[model samples]
Target: MEMTSRTKKFTYYRRKATNVIMLSSSFFSAIITIIPLFLVFYYTVREGLRYLNIDFFTKLPTPIGEPGGGMVNAIVGTLILIGIGGGIGIPVGMLSGIYLSEFGKNKFGTLVRFLADVLSGIPSIVVGVVAYTLVVLPMKHFSALAGGVALAILMIPTITRTTEEMINLVPHSYREAALALGIPKWKTILFIVLKTAWKGIATGVLLGLARAAGETAPLLFTALGNRFWSTNIFRPIASLTVFIYEYSKAPFKDWNEQAWTAALVLIMLISIVSLVFRLITRSKY
Candidate 1:
């Protein structure tokens, strides 16, 4: 009996020690992860605030050697590019996702899944090269359309996989219930499964948007960066990422400061996108 009691005490103490060690590890791991993010944000705000002003939002970028300018054109162009990307990406991604979740259990589906995973791993620069060949070359010029196409390709795999996972999370019982009510399979999927998983799908879309918004390589090959304001989808366009890249490398102090401000603005734009999507996707209940 004494031996058994000592054994029990030994086991208890060991478990307690393991738990404490794990908890400490997790605490330190989280602190390490968050510290870098905090430092980047703090530094960005410190440098960016020096040049941030009303003119930065309302006026056009000035010529080299000029004193002051804003990135209003780049801001507008970024929005338009995102809009174009979303228009092309959302429908194709959602449909592919639905098909994969519902009917992708066979060998063909396996092939498609493999392809998506491969596509997701491809470098953005490679996608830009492909887009340049497919759209820019045929059109005989770099254009916003080519950039939009590049962004859409980058967005597809993320949106498609996120959608498939979200849809699969819906209980099979929900589908059974809908079918038992004499509902058509198409209608049931469209109204029931889709509505239930919309929030998760929206998150995937937001992630894709954020990634596309920050991409410079793809836009460099496809859009080519414009100096003047132009909204034509067939024309080269400016964007925040390209502006930041160019300004950060300039010899002028003012342009370098504007780079910091542009970086901060890009962060703000991404945050705003996240917020708008969150509100739109909020639970109706």
Candidate 2:
């Protein structure tokens, strides 16, 4: 009887010790994950603060040898590229996703999902080459349109998979309820299913845009980068990623500072997009 009591107490303490060790390890793991993110933010702000100003956002890049300039054109070009890319990619991706979630239990759906996965894993440089061949070659110019096409291709797989997953998350009960209201299948999907899933879908789109914003290799072969201010989609345009790559590699001190500032700007842009999406998703319906 004493031996049984001793065994029970030992087992209780053993389980407690195991739980404590597990909890401690998980807590440390989280800290390890978060510390690097904080460090990167700290370094980027420290290194980039001196160069960030109204002029940096407003002026064009000065000549290479000259010191005082800004990345105004690059900022504008980045926005335009994302706009065009999102416009082209979002609709197609959503349509594909809707089909996959709602009507794709077959072999064709599996093939499409597999293809999307493969496309997402392909190197950004490879996408650039494909875009250059399809858009730049046909247009006979390295244009913002070509850059957008590359980014669009990169964005598509993300949006499609997110949309499919989010749509599936909408409980089948919701579908049944809507269908019982005498709604047609297509109408139920468009009005009920899509509206319910819009927030998650938007988050996926924003995440894709954020990922595309920092890509440089695709722009290298496709848009090919511009030196001057250019808003024309048909003409080559500058990008923040490309500008940062060029500036950071240059021997000039000022250009290097500008590169850090561009990195900060890119991070801020992505943060703002994520914040906006969060706000929209949580807003009162």
Determine the backbone clash count of candidate 1: 0
Q: TM-score per candidate, in order?
A: 0.89, 0.89
Residue 239 C-alpha lDDT in model 2: 96
| Collision count for each candidate, in order | 0, 0
- Per-model lDDT: 0.92, 0.92
Which runs in model 2 stand beyond 4 Å of their true positions? Answer: 1-35
lDDT score of model 2? 0.92
Cα lDDT of model 2 by residue, 24-130, tens digit: 99999999999999998998899889899999898999987887778899999999999989999999889999999999989999999999999899999999999
Error of 1 at 3 (Å): 22
Q: Residue by residue across 68-160, what tens digits does model 1's lDDT show? A: 889999999898888888889888888999999999989987888789889999999999999999999999999999999999999999999
